[model samples]
Target: MSRLVLLGLWLVCVLASAVAAIWMLIAVLSGSKRAWRLAVAHDPLANAAFGGNEDETISIRAGKAARAGER
Candidate 1:
């Protein structure tokens, strides 16, 4: 009876280890895919072509003042 209990415990440990390994692999794959997408989506030339210049300034305070004057 003691030997059977030991065997059952060992089997449970192995199954738990396998589940943990699979979960880690899935997490790593998802994070890598997200990093790849972010790297590909941020091109300065593409942003400029779409009139999204980083150097242009549209201040929040100025916008709020204009809106207040309009009202």
Candidate 2:
């Protein structure tokens, strides 16, 4: 009975470890993909995922466009 209990505990530990590792892997992969996309995309702030920036970023380019429009 003790041996069986120990085996069950070991199995549970292994399963928990595997699940944690997989969860971490998914999080890391998703985070890496987001970072890579942000690096390549000039949107900065990851606003593209939301409803902020479509073609141009407001923080960086909005000023220039505003100035051009004023002229």
Candidate 3:
């Protein structure tokens, strides 16, 4: 009788783990898609905040400065 109870508890734990893993996977995939959309839209602020390129490269900064000089 105790063996049956243990088996049932084990099964419940396994199912719960599987459900949690699936939920986490879905959340990650959804977030990645949203980030991709934001990148494709060229949202510099959002991209810099979430995508980890907070500092602009020297060349990019130079280009922007040059463009400003043109105006």
Candidate 4:
């Protein structure tokens, strides 16, 4: 019974996410800055998905990696 409840909760989260994604898609298409900010969600993959510059992201990551090695 607990497993079934967990599955139901998971499904609810999935549906909510899907709805949010669709809303974001509409907002993004309309060029809403707020929507873009929410879409980024401070995630590299999210930024990349929304047309962030790949070269810049790569250079930033590389610089961080290099700095870490120096520490």
RMSD of every prediction: 19.9, 16.0, 15.9, 7.9
lDDT tens per residue, model 1, 1-71? 69999999989968975775565567567775554444333344345445656443234334655889941
Q: Among these predicted structures, which one has the highest TM-score?
A: 4
Candidate 2 residue pairs in clash (backbone atoms < 3 Å):
none
What local lDDT score does residue 38 receive in model 2, on the 0 to 100 scale?
A: 39
Which has the higher lDDT value, candidate number 1 or candidate number 4? Answer: 4
Q: Which RMSD does model 2 reach against the true structure?
A: 16.0
For candidate 1, what is the lDDT? Answer: 0.57
lDDT of 4 by residue, 17-61 (tens): 788788788888898876776565535644455665543454466
TM-score of every candidate: 0.41, 0.41, 0.41, 0.51
Question: Which residue segments of model 3 deviate by more than 4 Å?
Answer: 32-71
Off by over 4 Å in 2: 32-71
In terms of lDDT, the poorest run of 10 residues in model 3 is: 38-47
- The digit string of per-residue lDDT tens for model 2 on 1-71 reads 69999999989968975775566567567775644443444354334545555665655455765778941
lDDT of 4: 0.68
Clashes of each: 0, 0, 0, 0
Which TM-score value belongs to model 1? Answer: 0.41
Give the residue spans of candidate 4 off by over 4 A.
42-71
